[model samples]
Target: MEKLRVSDACIGCGLCVAQNEKYFEFNDEGFSKVKQEDVEENDKEELLNIVESCPAQAITIEEEK
Candidate 1:
């Protein structure tokens, strides 16, 4: 499984959540948050889109062990 992480750079733009609601969500302060560490492999592309869509460059994907 892989986990999506939101860095400190997040400006709370909400773009990541907007791109893929299944994987990403917004925290109370409006920053991007990963709802799950495990996602279908086919959804990777959409996750990529979420990463790119983040205006604050706060999103990242990493393998989970």
Candidate 2:
């Protein structure tokens, strides 16, 4: 399985939140945070695209055994 994460490198640009509200959202500090950690198998491709498109390069996907 794959898990989603948002790093401290996030610049609070809101790009990830804007891209997918289901997976990302703004925290109290206004930085982007992972709304959900578990990534669905069917949503992998789309989520990967969103991860790559993040202007702050803060999003990451970790493969779990």
Which candidate number maximizes lDDT? 2
Local lDDT at 30 for model 1: 78
Q: In model 1, where is the ten-residue run with the lowest total lDDT?
A: 12-21
TM-score of 2: 0.92
Candidate 1 lDDT tens digits, 1-65: 77778888988777777767887788888777778767679998888877777777778888876
User: Model 1: runs farther than 4 Å from truth?
Assistant: none
Cα-based lDDT at residue 17, candidate 2: 88
TM-score of each: 0.82, 0.92
lDDT of 2 by residue, 25-49 (tens): 8999999999999999998898999
lDDT of each: 0.79, 0.91
For model 2, state the Cα shift of residue 51 in Å.
1.0
